[model samples]
Target: MSLLKEAFERFAPDYLERYGQSMLPSHRRCLTDISSCQTDALDGSLHVCQSCGHEHYTFHSCGNRSCIKCHHLRTDKWLDKQQDNILPTRHFHYIVTLPSELRPIMCSNQKKSYKILMTSAFDALQKLASDPKHLGGKIGAIAVLHTWSRAMIDHPHVHMMIPAGAYNKDDDTWIRGREKFLVPIDALKSIFRAIFMKRMRKALPKQIFPQAIWKKKWSIHINTFDSKVENLLNYLGRYVYRIAITENRVLAVSQTTVTINHNGEALHLRGEEFIRRYLQHVLPKGFHKVRYFGIMHSAHKQTRNRIKLLLMNEVIIPDRPVKKKSTRCLKCSSTLILSISVLAPRNFNCQASVHPP
Candidate 1:
């Protein structure tokens, strides 16, 4: 059994019994899905090899994005599509982080707060880049939301990848930005702070947007990539579809504690604490964690096509076919074909039965 599966099986009931009532419906649902994923609790299919007649039973996955076992294929597919959209110019990585004082508000109102975070970051970048004193044109950007620190605590932030430069309308030419810097960090912080506070005041309580945060500068960091395009893509792929933690990062789990590796360091957390931390990042149902803004937005096809033509010489990344991985017959080593499928149980208390056509 997987370590995560084992840990959940051993300790999830106690955690759920105590805290489930107070948790969000989505969090409760995520725990239930992860606890039952790829196990007998879910439906399975009986398969027979066409060539060798070897038979096996394959269980279905929960299909939850937070489930580590189920997201690899999905992540690969997302990466493939993103690779095709990358431009040839130097790309910069920008991180927009909310002040620590506002974390509680974000935790209580995740969907609203996260939307504000993304929008504020996008607006700040676009507004700065479009200024005449700056690059003075439009740019493309991909923003991804992440909600965990290296220690697994709540640390909400947005990671953005922007092409270094913009398309100038007046000269009808591309303007390259300085390799050392894309935009002024202080300016980005001020703009982001103002935009976030302005939006938060409309929905959140007045006290949540404190005067101290307004007085203190917000945290925003920008790093320019000097490496190859392949390296940049590989790095961004890690963030595109990752959960708070992966099964591989799990080192050991006990009745009371679980150990995990984070940033090359091993950290031990109580079993209940670990589950609580993991579920905090489960995300709201139907939330879009990755978004495109400016020229990269799907609605701007004309600009996107023109930019592609301009950067045609940078790199042409082909979208290769991803092989579907599946189970095979243990007896004959042949691929298995589904001969029987058990319909999903209508109620959680019931067992699914095979319904052959």
Candidate 2:
């Protein structure tokens, strides 16, 4: 079992008993799912080897987005799907972070705040990329929302991957950006801050936020990526499915404290405090951490295909189908067949072969 799961199984009940009434349903559900993940509390599948009649019983994954044990396969599959959409041109990576002053409001109003952050960031990018001084055309962007720092603090930011070129619909031409810079960092920062504050005020009409945050210079970091698009995509993929912390970072879990390794340094916190910090990043239910805009949007598939053909000078081919791997017996190294006895009693012994004679 993962150390994260163990920590939760040990401390979650006490944490919930103390704060369950005040916690969000999504947060509570994450606690339950992560604690019970891959345990007999959930369903399981029984597989029997066709050759040696060896029986293997495996518990089903909880499939919670916050569960560290889940989503490894999901991350790989999402990256594979994105390979078809990546453009051949250079791409720029942009990170737009929310001001620290607004974190309290953002935490209290998660769903609305997160949506505003993503849309505002994209809007800023769109406005700048369309200017005659910049690319002078509409650009494609993939925006991903990250809500935690490396140490699992609540630091909300949006990371965008944008092709360093734009498509002009008027005359059907491609306008390329500067080889090193996509847009002026100062201009992007100004635009992003303006859009974010404007929407934030509108979203929470009655709530009063610090006026200084409006004047605060929000952080915007832009870097040029000349490497393979997959490398960048892989980096962003890490944040999509998982939450604040992963299993490997967890070093030790005791009845009283939980220890994690951050940058080769050991950080310890009370189990309750650890649970509180982890739950802060659970996110609202059904929220999308990743979004596509402009030419990369699903609505612009044909336009993307056209651009691909123009760049590659060849007809675009459909992606080859991915074959599903069959499950195999651990002991016999033979393909396992699904048994109808999957619904067998919880006490059913794995040592007893259920394979047909």
Candidate 3:
């Protein structure tokens, strides 16, 4: 069992009993799923070895996006799908962060706030890139939302990967950006802040925000990468299907406390507090944390193809070797054949049987 799952099994019951009524349905579901993941609470399949006739029963995973036990395959599949659409040019990585003062409000209104944050950030980028002083053409971007800091604090931000160029549809030409700089950081910050505040007001009319946040400078980081976008995409893929914490990061889980390794430092928290922090990062049901905009949008596939054709000689995406799964039997070192079964009950168990022909 994963340390995270063990921690949840130990602490989730008491936490839920104390605060179940106030918890979001998604959070409640996450707790149940993680606690029962890859266990008898879920279904299982039977596998038989071809050589030694060893029968192994494997339980199904919870499939919950927040569950660390699941989504490894899903993340790989996402990266493979994105590889085809990646532009063959230098890209800029942008991190747009929500101010500390707005975290409470954002957490309270998760779905709405997260959606607004992503769109607002992309809108600012599009607005700036379209100006004649800048690239002056339509730019494509992939924006991903992250809600947790290294210490599992609620820090909302969007990471955007944008190719350092634009595609002008009018003339069917590609306009490359400067080698290092994409846009002025100060100007981008101003535009992003104004757009986010305006959208927040329109989305939450009744909520009042502190005026000081408007005056204070928001944190925005811009990083430049060469034509190889695989690294950037891989970094973004890590957060797409998983939640704040992972099983490997969990150092120890005792009856009363959970300890995690954060930035090489051990941080301990009470079991209940650990559960609280983990649940806080479970996004609302059906909320998409990764989004595409402008030319990167699915609707603009034709445009992207044209851009790729124009930059075919210059584009260089490294060959990504697919990681194959091991199907060999552990007991006999022979091939294992799988046969999926219908959903089984909690007590369901499979005895050793011959391999089915």
RMSD of each: 4.2, 3.9, 3.0
Of the candidates shown, which would achieve the greatest lDDT relative to the real structure? 3
TM-score of candidate 1 against the unseen true structure: 0.88
| Superior candidate under TM-score, 1 versus 2 | 2
Candidate 1 C-alpha lDDT tens digits along 46-100: 6677778765665677887777556666667777877767666788888889888
lDDT of 2 by residue, 214-308 (tens): 67788888788765566677788887898787778999998899999988999998999899889999888889989999999999999988887
Cα lDDT, all candidates: 0.77, 0.81, 0.86
* Model 3 regions more than 4 Å off: 348-357
lDDT of 3 by residue, 225-336 (tens): 8955889999999888887976789999998999999999999999988988888899988899999999999999999999999998885989678786666665876765
TM-scores for all predictions? 0.88, 0.90, 0.94
lDDT-better candidate, 1 vs 3: 3
The per-candidate count of clashes, in order, stands at: 0, 0, 0
Stretches off by above 4 angstroms in model 1 are 169-171, 315-327, 336-340, 344-357
Task: Please estimate how well model 3 matches the true structure, expressed as its whole-model Cα lDDT.
Answer: 0.86
